[model samples]
Target: MIDLAPWAWILLAIAGTVVGLSKTALPGANTVSVAIFAALLPARTSTGALLLLLVVGDLFALLTWRRHAHWPTLLRLAPAVAAGLVLGAVFLAVAGNAVVRPVIGAILLAMVAITLWRRRRTTAAPEGAAHLGTTLGYGALGGFTTMVANAGGPVMSMYFLAMRTPVKVFLGTAAWFFAIVNIVKVPVLAGLGLITVPVLLMDAVLVPMVVIGALFGRWLIPRIHQALFDRIVLILTVLGALYLLIP
Candidate 1:
């Protein structure tokens, strides 16, 4: 079982709450929780704890939007995502995020910059190789970042944003996608010695916070201005990336 100081547990609870909502309603806000949890705990432990909360959030998300998912998009990306996950597992077995986060963050930032630039240039959405390549690249990177720091939100968010999905389909598809992925991570994290019985126990104490946050996000999401919400997501992604890199 994992043990943490009181303050650390409190901080984790808060981060978990936001992460829950990010999964269900605010698709990009995950960067904030990743930054918060990584800043407060050992990178490995933070990854595990965040994974637990993600599962909780995943449950809420599926319950809310299970029917809304775009399964074709998810399937199209599955093979690459699996390849990325395998690479990420190998990386986590050898190195920590102290080296990974900065490199990955720089890459994510570059991707976002390129995406934004393309948006202004052709007035067309990102597509073809660049888009699919980013999917493959970021899929591995996403698994790596989440394995190390729970920081994949921005990476995935940028991909979804570039795809320019309608807001509801975007949020709904993300909900189902992450539900499956986060659950898969559980056994992986347990094998890595990051998840213990005690840690699971502590996680139960914080489940309520995740629920509340998800509920709040559910209510708040549809009400938000689409463009403004997307921009906020982008800014948070940058901030979350910076937080990990600098720390």
Candidate 2:
């Protein structure tokens, strides 16, 4: 069994709840959960453990938003995302926790800046369709961050927002994107010895919290104004990033 302090368990439970809420309603908020898990567990182990809980959250998101996904966009992003996953796997194999944590923090901060800049530049729809360069850049970054530390939400959220995706469509597309990407990561993490019997057992205990958060997200999403929702996600994302950076 995995040993954890009482306070750690309490924090993990809150993190699990946030994972579900992020999937179902707030797209970038899971960065906070990632920060919590990483703080409380071994960095690499936390990635694997959080990935399982995220997959569970992904399922609920998919069920709720599957119909809203934009397939063409997903297809466009596929190749770059795959390349990024491979790169991330390589990075994970060699980097220690000391290195990984700071890198994750940097990526999150960068994404937040990019998101704010993009939002300021345009409330209008993206000029023409998404360019190939833009697609590849966002796809690869999203894939790499997600694979390394489950921090892809903010990166891809910025991508969708830059494209001016409507709230429902954005949720749907992101739901499918993360669902498939996260599942693909399972075997890679398992091969790294990050996913193990104990991790699964721990996740089993936390699954219900994820479900509750998802349900809560579903109820809350429709009520939030889009502008307010976007600000909240970005602000939470910044805070999460800072947590990783601080000792």
TM-score, per-candidate, Cα-based: 0.79, 0.91
Candidate 1 TM-score over all chains jointly: 0.79
lDDT of 1 at 111: 45
lDDT of each: 0.70, 0.86
> How many clashes show up per model?
0, 0
Q: Give the Å shift of residue 163 in candidate 1.
A: 3.5
Pairs clashing in candidate 1? Answer: none
Per-residue lDDT value at 198 in model 1:
74
Give per-residue CA lDDT, model 2, range 149-243, as digits (tens): 89887678778877778878988999999999999999999999999999999999999999999999999887977687677767876776787
Looking at model 1, report the run of 10 residues with the lowest lDDT sum: 121-130
**Residues 1-247, model 1: lDDT tens digits:** 4567888778777777787777667755666676666666566666777789888888888888888888887776678777766766666667675765565455446545654564475436566434667677767766665555555655666566667766667767877777777787788888887787777887788889999889988888768776776687678667756766784
